[model samples]
Target: MSAFGTLLWLEFRKQGTFAMGMLMVVAGWSLLLRQFFAWGAEPSIVALAVVASTLMLAGAVVTAYLLWLGLDFAREYRNGRWALLLGAPQPGWLHLSARLLFACGVLTLFAAGMWGTLAFWLGRVGLEWPLGLGLALWAYGLGGVALVVPVLFIGLLVAAYLPARADLLAFLVGLLGLGQLLEWSLRLFSAQFYRWLPPWGLPLPRLGEMAWEGFPGLPSEAFVLLVLLCVLLFSAMSRLWQEVEV
Candidate 1:
């Protein structure tokens, strides 16, 4: 196999256990949420709203997974595994790209397992798959990706630049928590200002609201802007990785 293929395979191997654990968590959560809503007599608007809320929760799960993966990489760096991998005869960008691909692959699997479980439960409730469950799943998956890419990029940056793994993990948690606090403060105190601000201004609101109409969707210009942001962040992260001591 080619070098990139080999590295990609290695990345998958490293992540296998964690990925399985996450899949189990997603499955369990999906089943639990389904049971919570299934106690009702029939499907209602509230059920659809619950599905929407679940999608947002799924996005948070995916983001947390990505953060965990990035921190794992940082831990590997501290233990010299990352430097050993960098010693290989391949460009740094190729290695980073392979990691990105691995993340995308794992995320796709996660989304499938999560939405598939949800769909199964919806079917048990007599909902149509294509019209109701499938469409929502697709929207949720797309929105989740749109929400996760920038976070993954940020996590990569933290892992590459932060000298200590503990600091990297703490920074990730604080960053996410601060974003949520800011979003809540903004929404609570200044509704008009929140409406005027861009969709991506705060993480929680961005992830929660962007899946809806009148907010950023995967096909909209906002998504293109997010793609550009990811590219820029990834470039900066790659450069930092090259220059950092670890």
Candidate 2:
């Protein structure tokens, strides 16, 4: 395998147990919806149940993946493996790119799968395509990665600076959990305040409002903005990594 492939594969191996657990959780949710249908409901009620179940699945999957990505970055830093990898033959950007690909690929799969299931269920409910939901879901998943990338970067920096109170691993993981708190607080602020920021300002409103009709979905300009922001933040992160002292 190439360097990128090797790194991604290693990360994938580490994630197998978590992935299996999530799969079981999804299966259980599917069973619960099935149970609701078996309880003898009208078609309309069944359709409602399915939509509710699908939304629940999407919410859980997104939250879990974000937390997992944050924790994973912190764990690598705590173990000193991040520094070790950076010292190796691979470039820092390559290493980070691999990690980002792994994160985005896994979370995107979960998000897409949940929405695909929803699309199937809606079809059964006699609903048609262009329900104007799928693109919003896709953008939300991509935009989510864009938002979390900086969190992971900042979490690693914080972990490196903090003292080893408990195990480094424990402290690092806890630092990553701090991202969830950051996310919650950001939601409390209005977008009018946040839009000045690059990444969070872009995704937050679209994800919350499901407004696929405007800049993000319809206009190619939004796509350009998203790409530019990702590149800028990623470059800043690389510079920080390079400047970190051993």
Candidate 3:
């Protein structure tokens, strides 16, 4: 395998089990949801149940992945693997990229799966959600998930460099500060910068009376700004990664 591939494999070897377990739990929840749907007498009620359940699932998955992402590097500090990675010839970005890619890939799978699952359940109830809308939602969700990776990675690095026990507090504080900065930056984008950029609208299939006509699209600059912000955060993370002792 190539060096990047090797790093990806190493990440899998470290956290693959947890990822698999998480997937299984989601699968089990899907089955349970199916069973619950079968119990609903009203079509509208069952459809509402499906929508609410899907949202709940999405929120749970996001939260779980957040913890998982933070732990990806934090766990290494305790398990003696940190020394091995510090000794490797790979650059710090390679290591960070591998984890970021892995985590993002997992969430992508999750979003796709949930979208398909909702389509299936909704089909059974004679309601159809648009593919365009699903894709839009998936992109929006995955973007949120992917963007936080840099913050979490930096938090892990901060925690690792601190004394034990105290590290937890340091990590949370770092995340809070970074998160606040991100919020402020986004506010600025919304207040002034967003208007300067073109609107990136979603194209929905016209289903006659069922078509959505008035949903405003997001500014293209919102996405560009997010990408730039993540790049900045990841760059800072790379610099901090080298400071961790072997």
Candidate 4:
């Protein structure tokens, strides 16, 4: 197998297990909530739960990605594997691309599993399955870049700069989680304001809400702006990664 292929497998092997464990946890909580709470049967409530749970699951995946990348890179650097790889004929972008592909694949699985679970629950509730599923996945995909970019920036910084990989990963994860908590708190105060910010605060899809009604669907101008923002983020991340110390 190629080096990239081997790296991908190792990443999947580690992350797939975590994804399975997350699935079980989400399933158990969903089942329990359905059995105990009448509110869980309400479409809006259930949809919100689904969204929140999926977001949390996605966050867990991001956390895992950051942790693994940080640790793996740190180990490689410590053991001089990084130097070996650099000495090889392989391009720097190849290593970076392999890592990016691993991240995208893992994140896609997490997003798919969450949307699938949401579809099943919506089906049980007699809601329109396709719309619900489509909206769930589309919104998650659109919003994912915001979260991924920040996580990537922090992860690379920690991996390449920090002397203590474990401590840095722990601190970064805690900081990310804290940011989410603050976002949730702010949303409780005013969702409109939250929608104006990045990460959790950005406007994404609304399953039943119509775009013409000026809901979470981005306006034409804002959509263009968001695309630009994504481009800028990608460029910035690429530059940072290139400059990252071993």
Candidate 2 residue 179 C-alpha distance from true site, Å: 14
lDDT of 1 by residue, 1-246 (tens): 998889888888888878788788877777577555656654644346556766777777777876686577668757977666645667667887887677777777776776676566655555533433444444445544444445544555565556666656756774796477446644554644334445432111212222334534223333444465567656765665565554
What is the TM-score of candidate 4?
A: 0.52
Which one wins on TM-score? 3
Q: In order, what is each prediction's RMSD in angstroms?
A: 8.7, 7.9, 4.1, 8.9
The candidate scoring highest on lDDT is: 3
Q: Show the lowest summed lDDT stretch of 10 residues, model 3.
A: 203-212
Comparing 3 and 4 on TM-score, the stronger one? 3
User: Please, what are the lDDT tens digits per residue for candidate 2 over residues 1-246?
Assistant: 798889888878977667666666666665565665575776666766777767777777778777887787677767888668656767667777877787777766665666566666556545443434566666766777786756746654554554544346654664575556455545543334345545422232222223335444333334445576578668866765665544
lDDT of 4 by residue, 207-229 (tens): 46522253354333334344555
In model 4, the runs with Cα more than 4 Å from the true position are 13-16, 23-33, 36-75, 78-80, 129-216, 219-246
When 1 and 2 are scored with TM-score, the better candidate is: 2
Candidates, ranked, TM-score:
3, 2, 1, 4
Per-residue lDDT tens digits for candidate 3, residues 1-246, read 799999899778876887777677667766777775668677667777877878787877778777776665567667878778766777878888887788777777777777777777777777777677777776677676655656556665664656555776777777787789789898998898877887778765332245557978655775777788888778877766666655
Q: In lDDT terms, how accurate is model 4?
A: 0.56
Candidate 4, after superposition: displacement of residue 74 in Å? 4.2
Clashing residue pairs for model 3: none
Worst ten-residue run, lDDT, model 4? 210-219
lDDT of 2 at 137: 63
Off by over 4 Å in 3: 147-153, 156-184, 199-222, 243-246
Q: What pairs collide in candidate 1? A: none
